[model samples]
Target: MTSSDPHAPHCHNVPGDKSAVQPDKKRLVSRLNRIEGQVRGIARMVDEDRYCVDILTQLGAIRAALDGVAMQLLENHANGCVAKAIGAGNGEDAIAELMDVVRKLKS
Candidate 1:
């Protein structure tokens, strides 16, 4: 799971206390559950033989919703983990990590 890119910055610093990352986990799980429901609803639509255009529209909505959730998680990571890393003198590494994710998202 580790990136081998030489230019990729790495973080070996973890929160001294695990509780610091708990909220991110909780929010991620909650968002994923909502996405799961959306997926199941789409499946039901298919079973009901919904119109192709309607199904495609719903799929687009699901994608946008998932992207919204992703943005929220990224914001949280920036404010929490990245901020902490910067405060601890690892700002370059943190920024690099964020940039890498942004690049991945773009692709």
Candidate 2:
């Protein structure tokens, strides 16, 4: 049976070409590497029984860093993938997918 949900079986619009050209691959990788290091640092802090407040602060920083990465990725999607889909007359699905991710990011 068909469902209204974009994620429903038979309604999914996964792109055939999974590898979209990423102009900022290097920058994104660099940021992710730093975030990974920060995560490891937080793990160490937890193991050392660090102050709760300090650990909380570090957690907040990591969330912000992750949000920054999300924003960059969203921008890249809008400028590259979404734009291409629009040009190809498949913008409706593209935009729906974009909005879905946007709602997720806001949460």
Best by lDDT: 2
Worst 10 residues of 1 by lDDT: 1-10
Per-candidate TM-scores read 0.72, 0.84
Residue lDDT tens for model 2, 15-41: 673555456677789999999999999
Instruction: Note the Cα lDDT for every prediction shown.
Output: 0.73, 0.77
Candidate 1 segments whose C-alpha is farther than 4 A from its true place? 1-12, 15-28
Pairs of residues at least 3 apart in sequence or in different chains that clash in candidate 1: none
Give me the displacement of residue 94 in model 2, in angstroms: 0.5
Total colliding residue pairs, candidate 1: 0
Name the 10 consecutive residues with the lowest summed lDDT in model 2: 1-10
- 20 Cα displacement, candidate 2 (Å): 1.4
Give the Cα error of residue 48 in candidate 2, in Å: 0.4
